[model samples]
Target: MAIGLFYVILLGCVLLNVCFYFYFSKVCFSNPTTYTKNVTPVSVIVCAKNEEENLKRLVPQLLSQDHPNFEIILINDASTDDTRFVIEEYMAQHPQIKMVDVVNNETFWGNKKYALTLGIKKAVNDHLVFIDADCEPASNQWLSLLSSPLKNDTTIVLGYSGYHKAKNSLLNALIRFETVLAAVQYLGYAMRGNPYMGVGRNLAYTSKQFYDVSGFMSHMKVMGGDDDLFVNEAATGNNTAVVIDPEAFTMSKPKQEWNKWWIQKKRHVQTSKLYKTKHKLSLGLFFTSQIFFFIATILGFLFGLQWEAILSLVLIRYVIVWIVMGKGLSRFRESELIPFFPLLELLLVFLQAGLFISNITHKPSRWK
Candidate 1:
C-alpha cells in the first residue's frame, strides 16, 4: 500500500509538471520571427567597472545595431582599469557613442544602480534599454526587436540572456542549462501574468515607469539589486512583456571557475527576498515543489523504500523538468546539448539547493 501510494504521489507531481509545461509553452512565448521596423526612440545604458576588455568588443556590437534613433550610454563606474581610456578612444572615433563618468557621487554610494541612474538621467530618449558590459546582442536588429514590444506596453520588456559558448566542459553545459531554465521559468511565468525578475544583460524599460517605482530603494545597499531587484519592483501584470525572439537575445560569458560562479549565483539569489509578495509566493511554491520532489525520490530509493514507486516518481519529476527545459532550450537554440540533459538536470538541482542554502546564511556577496 505504501509503495502504491508513493507512485501515486510521484505521478501526481509529474502530471502537475506536465500540465504547467504545456500551459506555459502554449501561452507565454511566441516565436519572434516577425521583425518590426524602427518605432521607438531608445537609449542603451551600459554600466562598467574594469571591463575594458569586454567593453572593446561589446560596445562596437551595440553601435552596429540596426536601430534608427538610439544612443549608447556607457557609464564608467570608477574603474581602476583603462575602461575610461578605451571608451574615450571609441568616443573619439564614433560620434554617436556617449560616455558618462560615475566617479565620486556622494548621494548614491558607488554601485551599478547609481551608475545606471546617472546614465538614465542624461539619456535623451524615451525608451531605456539596458545591457551589461560583458554582453553582446545576438543580431544587429537586437535593439529593434527588444524595443518593438514597447508599442503595446510602455512599462517593461524582458529579454533573454544566455552564456556564450565556451569550450565544451560540464561547467559550461550546466551554466547554459541554468540560463535556459531561468529564461523558461521567468518568461513562462510572465505568460501567466506573474512576471517576477528580469536579467539586466538585456532588459528594456521606460524612464517614467522606473521613476514611478522609486527605483531600487528597497534593495539599495544590496550588492546585486540593479537588475533582478529592479525588475521585481518595476514589473506588473498589464505592463510587463517578455521578448523571446532570437534577435533580441543577449549573450554573456559564463564564470570560468566554480567558486566565482557560486559567488555570482549567491549574489543574484540574494535579491529574491525583496520581491513582491505574489512573486515571492510563486517562487516559494516552485522551489518547495522542487525540494519535495528531490527529497521524496531520494528517500524512496534508500532502504528499498518502495524502489519501483520511487523510481517511477523520480522519472516523472525528471520528465516534467525535461519537457519544460527542453522546450526552452529548443527555442533558445540550445538543443545541441539535449543529449546531456540528465547530467545537466542533476547538477542544477544540486547546485541550486547548495546555493539557496548558502544565500540564506552567507555574508553580503561582493562583485569581485
Candidate 2:
C-alpha cells in the first residue's frame, strides 16, 4: 500500500510539472517573450516612511526616465526622518516632482494604502506606476517598458523586481531563487490570463482601474498587501498583462540576516489569507506538489524503494521545469540558480511551511 501511494504521488508531481491544470503554464513557456509599449503620459508614485537613504539614489533615476511626459509623486508617509526634506529638495529643483505629505492618525497609523491613495489623488496623469523608494529602475527605459503593456484590455501591468546580487552569501542566493520562482508562477499565470498578485516595487495600473475596484478599501487595514491585495481584487485575465524585459526590471537591496528576512516573509504570508479561494487552491496545489516531490525523492532513495522509478520521475520533473521556466530565469538574470534548483526548492518549501504555521500560532507585528 505504501509503495502504491508513493508511486501515485510521483505521478501527481509529473502531472503538475506538465502544468495541464488547465494547461497551467505550458502556453507561457512556449510563447516567446514580447512587450507592447504605449508612450502614454504617466504618474510615478513612491511612498516612503523612513527610506531617506534609498530615496537619494532613486530620485535621480526617476528624474531621468526616458518617457516624455511623466510626473513623480513622492508620498512622505509621516516619516520622522529626513524623508520629507529629501522630497522637498527634489520638488524645489524639478516641477515634475510632486509631494503628498501624510500625517499619521489613530485610524490608519502605519497604513501604506492610505498614504498611497492620497498620492494617487495627487497624480495629474490618469495612468500610474508604483515603485518602492528603495527600488532603482534597471534603465532609463524602465518606466516606458513597465507601462507599455497596460493598453487596450490590459489595465494592470506587472513587471519583475529583483535584488542586487551579492557574493558569498547563501541568504542572497536563496532570496534571488525564491524571487525568480515567484515571478515565474505569477507572470506565467498572468500570461495564462489569471494574474493573482504583483510586486508593488514594479507594478502599474490606471486610475480608472483603481477607481473601478474602489481602490484598497476592501483590505485597507491589512498589513503589507497594498500591492498584491489590490491586484487580487482588481486584476483579471482580460485586464492584466506582464513584462519580461530586463530593462523593465526594478532592483532593491535584499535583507542580509536570516531573522530579518524571516520576519519580512512572515508578514508577507499574512496577506495571502485574503486571496480568492480558487487562487489559494491553485497556488496551494503547486506548492504542495513541489514539497511532496522533494520529500518523496528522499524517501525513495533512503528506504531503497523503487529507485529506478524514482530516478526516472526525478529526471522528468527537472527536465520539464528547465524547459518551461528557464527563459524566465534568464530574463531575470538568475540562470545561475538553475543548477541549485533542487536544493533551493527544498529549503524554500520547508522554510515557508514553517512560516505559515508560525503565523497561524502568532501573528507578526506591523512595521513602517
Candidate 3:
C-alpha cells in the first residue's frame, strides 16, 4: 500500500510537470502575437557603476544599432573608475550618445532603480530600450525588433538577454542552462498573455508605461528588480509583447565563480518573492511539482517498487522537457547544452532547493 501511494504521488508529479511543459511547448511552435513595424524614436538607457572597462566595449555596439533615430543614455551610477571618462569620450564623438552623471548619494548608493530613474527622466524619447553595460547587442537589428512591437496599445517588450557561451566549464553550462530555462518560462508565459517579469539586460517600455506604475516607486525599498518588479506590477495581456527574434537578443557576461553566481541567484530569488499573488501561486505550483518529481524518482529506485513504471514516467517527462527546452536553447544559441539536459535540470533542482534554504537563513545580499 505504501508503495502504491508513492507511485501515485510520482505519477501525479510527472503529469503536473508535463502539463506545464505542454504549456511551455506552445512557445516553440506558437506565433502568439503579430506586431507592426515601429520606427518610433527610442532612448536606450544603460546604468553602470565601476564598469568603465565593460562600457568601452558595450557602448560601441549600442551606438551601432541600425535604427532610424535613437539616443543612447549612459548612466554612470557614481562609478569610482573611469566610467565617466569613457562616456564623455563617446559623447564627444557621437551626437547620439548622451550621459547621465549620477552623483553618489549614500542614501541610494549602488541602487540600480534610483540610478535608472535619473536616466529615464532625462531621456527625450517616449519609446525606451534598456541594455546592460556588460552586454553587447547580437546584431544591429536588436533595437529595431525590440522596439517594433511597441505601439499605442503595446507598452512593454520583454527581450532575451543571453550569456557568452564558455567552453569546458560545467558552471558556465549550468548558468546558461538556468538562464535559458528561465527565458523559457517567462517568455512562454508572456506568449500566453501572462508576463510576470522581464530582465533589465534587454527590455523596453514606453515612458508612459513606466510612469503608469509610478516607475518602480512601488518596490523602491527592495533591491534588484528595476526591470522585473516593474513588469510584475504593470504588464498585462493588453499591453505586453515578447520579442524572440534571433537578432533582437543581447548577450551579457556570466559570472565565472560559483560563489559569485550563488550570490547573484540569491538576489534574484529574493526579488521574485514579491511577485503578485496569482503569479506566486502559479509559479509555486510548477516549482513544487518539480521538487517532488525528482524526490519521487530517487525513492522509487531505492524502494524497488515498480521500477519499470518509474523509469517509463521519468523518460516521458525527460523527452517532453528535451523537446520544449531544446527548441528554446537552439533559438537562444545555447544548443550545445541539449545532450546534458536531464543532468543539468537535476542540478538546477538541487540548486534551487539550496537557494530557498539559504534565503531563509540569510537575507539576500544587495547588488552593488
lDDT of 2 at 322: 66
Candidate 2 achieves a global lDDT of: 0.86
Ranking by TM-score: 3, 2, 1
lDDT of 1 by residue, 30-81 (tens): 6553536756789999999999999989988988888778888988998999
Clashes of 3: 0
Tens digit of per-residue lDDT, candidate 2, span 1-368: 98999899888887775673334353335443566556789999999989899899999999898898999999999999999999999999999999999998999888899999999999988889999998999999899888887777879989889998999888999999889878877887888888899999999999999999899999988877888899988999999878877888999999999999998998888998889999999888887887787888888899999798899988987887766556556767888877877777779999988998899887775666
Better of 1 and 2 by TM-score: 2
Count of backbone clashes, every candidate in sequence: 0, 0, 0
- Name model 2 segments beyond 4 Å from true: 20-37
Ten-residue region with minimum lDDT total, candidate 3: 29-38
lDDT per model vs. reference: 0.79, 0.86, 0.89
How does residue 182 of candidate 1 score in lDDT?
Answer: 79
